[model samples]
Target: MNYYKDNVSTNVVTSNCNYVVTVKDWPAFLNEYNNFSNTTLAAYNAAYLQLGGGGNVAPGVSFLLKFGAFLNLYKADPSSDEYMPLKLNQNNA
Candidate 1:
């Protein structure tokens, strides 16, 4: 997820059943998450690379910038409602 300016945000969600599995056990959930991260990151990186570069930045630079900005915004105003209403949609079998 990424936050822009005061109240704007964006995110990416995968429809793959293997992603974001809901399990009661923390360890199992984390293990599944780790696996998903590896696959998702690889796919994202590939697609990002195909988009070419942005000026002096690399293909994945835009995503990194947005993520960094979001982190900064969160750090600045953690209690702000601008970051609320976290919308998470799970797509899986």
Candidate 2:
């Protein structure tokens, strides 16, 4: 089954934040999951827990798989995962 994208959030700055519903459907799912407003690591853990069990075989396998895909994508793209620190050139600029 195709895992549809859903609510996604990212933090532009560090602070306690709330998730804004950036997108509602497929297009929105991709857009928002790729780009977020204020979702936290702890929040993600909680969500994962709420999903029941771990791995793609868990209760909400589809949803978890979609999240896993987004996580991979987030790791791959710099502009996407703001939580990731930019690698600074060792040479003094």
Candidate 3:
């Protein structure tokens, strides 16, 4: 089966071994995911350059900065899953 929303298309597949699964606008999802990833990477690269492109900065700080960039990108897209809080198992691992 196929579905479309906001001009994006999705295909659904099912079988005896599989449940009712939905892709939900795959092409648009990929495009948006790639855009967010690329933008975050670019921001991280710029920060690395500013920090002399070496081990001159703390790794935690660098990670936080890159994460902040990702948050900014997510904020720009209200429909993105990036805004969802991560769920972990009881083991927390």
Candidate 4:
């Protein structure tokens, strides 16, 4: 044990850190979240379009973007949307 410790490292240390988070406005926060979602969906659409829609891209660019953004927001809030039902309806068989 002594030999292993000596060879592995000269010393060991522990970390002590603290963090604070602030969210002042709920409505504003939700608004900004959808704004961010819009930007992200725009990027997704741009990427998909860049690839050039050929076949089997899995739905249209706009729907796919909204679906993806919904997933991310649902992760944060666990709320409702059209795609949520479809996602929850998975067979799992």
TM-score of each candidate?
Answer: 0.21, 0.26, 0.23, 0.24
Greater TM-score among 1 and 2 belongs to: 2
Q: Rank the candidates by TM-score, best first.
A: 2, 4, 3, 1
Give me the displacement of residue 19 in model 4, in angstroms.
Answer: 2.9
Q: Which is the leading candidate under TM-score?
A: 2
Candidate 4: worst 10 consecutive residues by lDDT? 72-81
What would the per-residue lDDT of candidate 4 be over residues 31-87, giving only the tens digit for each residue? Answer: 757766878787755755655353334333323333333322111112322221122
Question: Sorted by lDDT, highest first, which candidate order results?
Answer: 3, 2, 4, 1
RMSD value for candidate 2: 13.7
**Can you tell me which runs of candidate 3 are displaced by over 4 Å?**
1-54, 69-93
Error of 4 at 14 (Å): 14
CA lDDT scores, all candidates in order:
0.35, 0.38, 0.39, 0.36
Per residue, candidate 3 scores C-alpha lDDT tens digits across 1-93 of 343543342222223111112233456556656866778787756756565435565433443333333321111123332332222234331
lDDT of model 3 at position 50 = 69
lDDT of 2 by residue, 64-83 (tens): 34443333221123333333
Candidate 1 lDDT: 0.35
Any idea what lDDT model 4 has? 0.36
Q: What TM-score does model 4 achieve against the real structure?
A: 0.24
